[model samples]
Target: MTELMRTTSATLSRLWTGSARHLTDDELTAVATGETVAQRTLAHLDQCQRCASSLVHAADAIDLLQEEASASFDKAYTTERHQAQRRRIGRRLATLVGTESPGKVIHFPFSGRPLPQLSARSGHWIAVASAASLVIGVSAGQLLHFHAAPAKPISSDGVAVTESAQTVPLTFDMTGTVKLPLLGDGLQHPAGEWSSLTLEEFDELMGNPAFFGNDDLALTNFLMSEFGSIDALTPHVSDLPVNIQ
Candidate 1:
């Protein structure tokens, strides 16, 4: 312990300029097994409270492991077991020194190969196409507006008046040809006296009066020929034959 303190003081005297660093596994192992180590390791162990605490913890854990191992094994195998454990610990310490931590390598966009650029000719063509499309759209809009139907005039009541409400006098000439007239609102100027005639008078006018004369005999014959007999139509009780039994 006195020699350890002297070595530690000598290390501190040599490297007392800056902050002390943490001890590596090899340095810690050397300290634990009483092997010669760098003076800086000893100096750091003396100055750094965290490293000193870690060394103490490691020593306690090793002692606990040895105690547990001795309890499981016989006294005859004690020396061999201790030697083997030390050898294993040394090999592990050496591996820890040689091993390096993996690092992350990030690759950002545009960090490697350059991006392909658009050519001047392609850009000019794209602009020309865009301008043509704009002009075509404008012309189409104007053409649609020109072809649209005009709006009907609106009245004072906020309703659209498609045609005039007042009636228009319609006239047609039928000087040389015959014209048939009808009653009611449609014809204001009737050509013939057909509207003034009653239904009976119209029927009389349309009938062939010269062929079937105005006398009642001709009418009776016509009626009898069309219908069966006047007796059957009139159904007089006097015409019925009496059966006197």
Candidate 2:
């Protein structure tokens, strides 16, 4: 009997110093299930002031007992509250863990169309072709403008000469044609004549004696004033005849 009392006292002392202050959820469950570890722990707790105080706060009306009883009213009430709380938490955890979505399939609404789709390579080729056509059209217009001549000739010997100048009809093959009533005259020159001048020729002409002064300083200042900066002039210089390199 003395040994039993000493063993029970030592166990209670250990519980009071160790896990009694803050019992884990597992420990509380173990206590609910009447496990030997939990029973021994409770026996120690009954004798311990700190465990007894904590127990009062944990379950106010439940009678602390060293031996198991068959469904005591206080114990049943305490167990029911704890089990309800655990079940609520368990249900929440299950809802969180069980939520999963199905895989999705994406559909394009306007995949099929009359317009041809262009790849990167096709786009690049188109840009190159457009640039080439622009260059060619400009070159042809400039050629016509620089070579334009008067219909009649005035000779040095003061002779009246009847000369008919040969004219080549300009024809453009385009996707669509719209004839403007005012501009539909057959003798009108095609547009974009000055567009044929290369970057080098443009720069040289801009700096020529006929335009700005032929001095480098005057040309640089004029270009900077017109274009905002010297860097802006570099791209146009490459288009000029003298600065093609």
RMSD of each: 27.8, 21.1
Worst 10 residues of 2 by lDDT: 236-245
lDDT tens digits, residue span 120-208, model 1: 98899999999999999999999999889755444343233333221212223423222223323347854323333344543454474
Candidate 2 backbone collisions, by pair: 12-44, 198-239, 199-239, 199-240, 200-239, 200-240, 200-241, 201-240, 201-241
Candidate 2 vs. true structure, TM-score? 0.25
How many backbone overlaps does candidate 1 show? 0
Question: Which stretches of candidate 2 lie above 4 Å from their native place?
Answer: 1-36, 59-109, 114-128, 133-245
Candidate 1 has what TM-score? 0.26
lDDT string for model 2 (20-61, tens) is 455655665455555656554675566667655655554533
Candidates' C-alpha lDDT: 0.57, 0.50
Whole-model lDDT for model 2 versus the true structure? 0.50
**lDDT, model 1, position 142:** 93
* Model number with the top TM-score: 1
List runs of model 1 lying over 4 Å from the truth: 1-33, 37-60, 63-117, 164-245
